[model samples]
Target: MSNNHNPAKPLQSILAIMAHPDDAEFCCGATVRQMSDAGADVTYIILTNGDKGNHNLSITVPELVKTRMKEQRAAAEILGVKDVIFMGEEDGFLQPNRELRRRLVRHIRKIKPDLIICQNPEMFFSGDRYINHPDHRNAGLVVIEAVFPAAGNPMFFPDLLAEGYEPHSIRELWICMAPEPDHKIDITDLLDVKIQALRQHESQFDDLDEMEKWVRERWSEENEAGEQRYYESFKRMKFD
Candidate 1:
């Protein structure tokens, strides 16, 4: 277990596989920005359209999906992400099914990313307050299944081979919100960028100031010098 940067090779490309539009922004925006600044090409694979994210009954599902995708694109742009791919799965109903796994495998082989940052599959509940979203857990499982025997093994998806998405093995996987995180990336200097990226989800948050305040309070901590700092922790796994 190592907290410092543990990838044997410098990251050249990164792919964030997540459940919803703002998932990447809320979880790992600053880290993505930092990596992009350091010359890594970063792409986001949003597994769902986020159609059920809003409480306004007046808005149609199609309308909400469009709004969220626009917001997600803007947020990824703020984080300097190279591309954002929306998988358009129905909101609140993602699954680690064979169909979804094949789709994810196609992307993994096509992107050939050095690092894949994803959700945590086993987070069922948080303390006594929040029940983890089903989509989140399923999203994590989808990525895990794809990254294993499916994406790297040519035998798993013979059709993808014809599509020219060759088998590609990843170097590392960083699971966000992991219960036993062994790696923590300090983003003390990039807190503003992280919050700014998240604020792009206008349809999701009613009060920008309140959201910003909550985020700072939730993610910040006092250092030995009594100065506040920010970091995102993950369970990192390296491959052979």
Candidate 2:
């Protein structure tokens, strides 16, 4: 991750599919920013509206959804994301099903991205002993399936084709918070941008400084072990 300028052209487009509003920011904001700065078109597909992400018992679900959506848009803007798509699924009740796969496939075909970024499908338990949310896990599975035969095979979703969305194949996929990562990006130069982008999710966090400190502490370990001052890790999957 030593800022190795390969002189190779960057991938043209990237689509990040995640569970909630802040999932993209918490998991891969730095990496997304780095890609955008390098001239890659970055897009986000948020699965849920994050209706239940508040501890305030007085707030209504609709109110929380609106607030979270606004925060997520602001955060995406900071990262230079080209577009944000919301699936509008219910929070905390996500299920990996054919409908979810179809919707995800439709986006994949429409976006026609070279790289698809998403959460790790296998990460059900955190090393910190925190139980991973089922919605996150569900989104991961749906994304993985959507990136595969569902998106590439026209027969799987013929209606999408009728709507003018042709099958689009994605060759490279990256999984965030993967237990085994084979790829790493140096984000040292963009740490400030990443922290700032993450701060946009103000609704989810009470203390921005504490969140920033947590990010530094987590990435610092990877930075020290790798060849870069700061790095974001990913498990790379290749279709070809």
Candidate 3:
């Protein structure tokens, strides 16, 4: 776990691992913008193509995948992200397995990000109102495993080491939408950037205005007990 209690310290690099194209934008776009704006290198790892994102049965998976990939690139550019890597996995069917962990470990080694951000793996259900996507939970668990023993231990992924990717130890892991968040980043100044980034994913939303409003209200609710105007909260786990 991390020894640093101060959340304001600037991290040199940040990597966001998410299940779909717009997950990063919806969860932590402002945070990514803030970090990148502060001169930190930011990268995105999208584990799925988001082909099954559209509810309309008429839309084909290949078409949706291409559109989602394009939107992801645009969104990443808007957030000042240095790179957006797609794992080419089928949407809605991600699994936490050795192959997935090995792939994630390779990226962890290659990126060597100081901070790794992802979804909450344990958030399966939310008060009957919503059910967390299986892909999101799987991606979270995969990243958590990859960041720990797989990425840091040289023996875990021997092929990666042989391929010239060195073991990289992450300083912190940040899980978004966690049940208990220990860190909150005030993102009032970057809210507009986040909204704009989300707008890039036009294929997913029927009404962008409503989407933006819901996001704003959600984040605002997180700040009702704090002094921060608009905030993004995360469960921070520090590792040596």
Candidate 4:
């Protein structure tokens, strides 16, 4: 995340596709903030309504959905994201199915972002303590599938083309929480910005201070000379 080790450039536009409202914030908030600061028009696509994330039995599913959407918008605004699109897929039951892929293709074709940030489709589990969320894996798969063979191929969805969402292909792809990340971007300066964005999701956390502390300590690293740094790593791919 230091020096020329990074991409050394800012993109024209970025789209972060995630399984839930807070997923993008947790995975790539700081990176998105940096990109937006550098003048990238950033848009977020939350694939699920995030209705199931709350444990409060008093809150109904429909109410939670509306609340989460509001929180997501506030969070995205804080990060300078230009737009937030909620796919409204049921939480926890997302699948990498044809319907979703086609829908994603339509969105991708319309957004026409040069860079896309997504989660890891192949990750079924993480460390010994956690099993990766099904929605996360499925969301990644849906994005990748749409980006490939679909969004760029007019034949995949002829209706989309007729509707004027002409075939569009992204120039670069970045996967967060990838098993093997080859690149890291320094986000040491946007730590506060990231925290503020995450804070917008008020219904997700019971203890805000504790959550903030965890986030700070999670990505912080110190060099030999006591210089602390933070980063967001990604698996990057480019197309000619």
Clashes of each: 0, 0, 3, 0
Estimate, for each residue in 63-168, the C-alpha lDDT of model 4 and write its tens digit: 9999999999999999999999999999999999999998999999998999999999999998998899999999999999999989999899898899999999
lDDT of 3 by residue, 1-240 (tens): 122334576588999999999999988899998888778899999999998889898888888899999999999999999999999998889999999999999988988899999999999997779999988899899999898788999999788999999999998899998988888888888888899999999999999999999988877744466564777889988875
Please, what is the whole-model Cα lDDT of each candidate in the order they appear?
Answer: 0.91, 0.86, 0.89, 0.90
The collision pairs in model 3 are 1-238, 1-239, 2-238
For model 4, which pairs clash?
none
| Candidate 4 segments exceeding 4 Å error | 1-10, 223-226
- The RMSD of every model to the true structure, in order and in angstroms, is 2.3, 2.1, 3.1, 2.0
Candidate 1 Cα errors over 4 Å, as ranges: 1-8, 223-226
Can you give the lDDT of residue 220 in candidate 2?
Answer: 66
lDDT of 3 at 211: 95
lDDT of 2 by residue, 1-240 (tens): 243223464567999999999999878898888778778899999999999898998998888898898999999999989899999999999998999899899888988998898988787798776898989888889998888788988898899999999999986888998887888877778888888988888888888899999988777644444554767888988765
What's the TM-score of every candidate structure? 0.95, 0.93, 0.93, 0.94
**Model 3 TM-score on a 0 to 1 scale:** 0.93
Q: Clashing residue pairs in candidate 1, if any? A: none
Q: After superposition, how far is residue 198 of candidate 2 from its true place, in Å?
A: 1.1
CA shift of 36, model 4, Å: 0.8
Q: What's the best-to-worst order under TM-score?
A: 1, 4, 2, 3
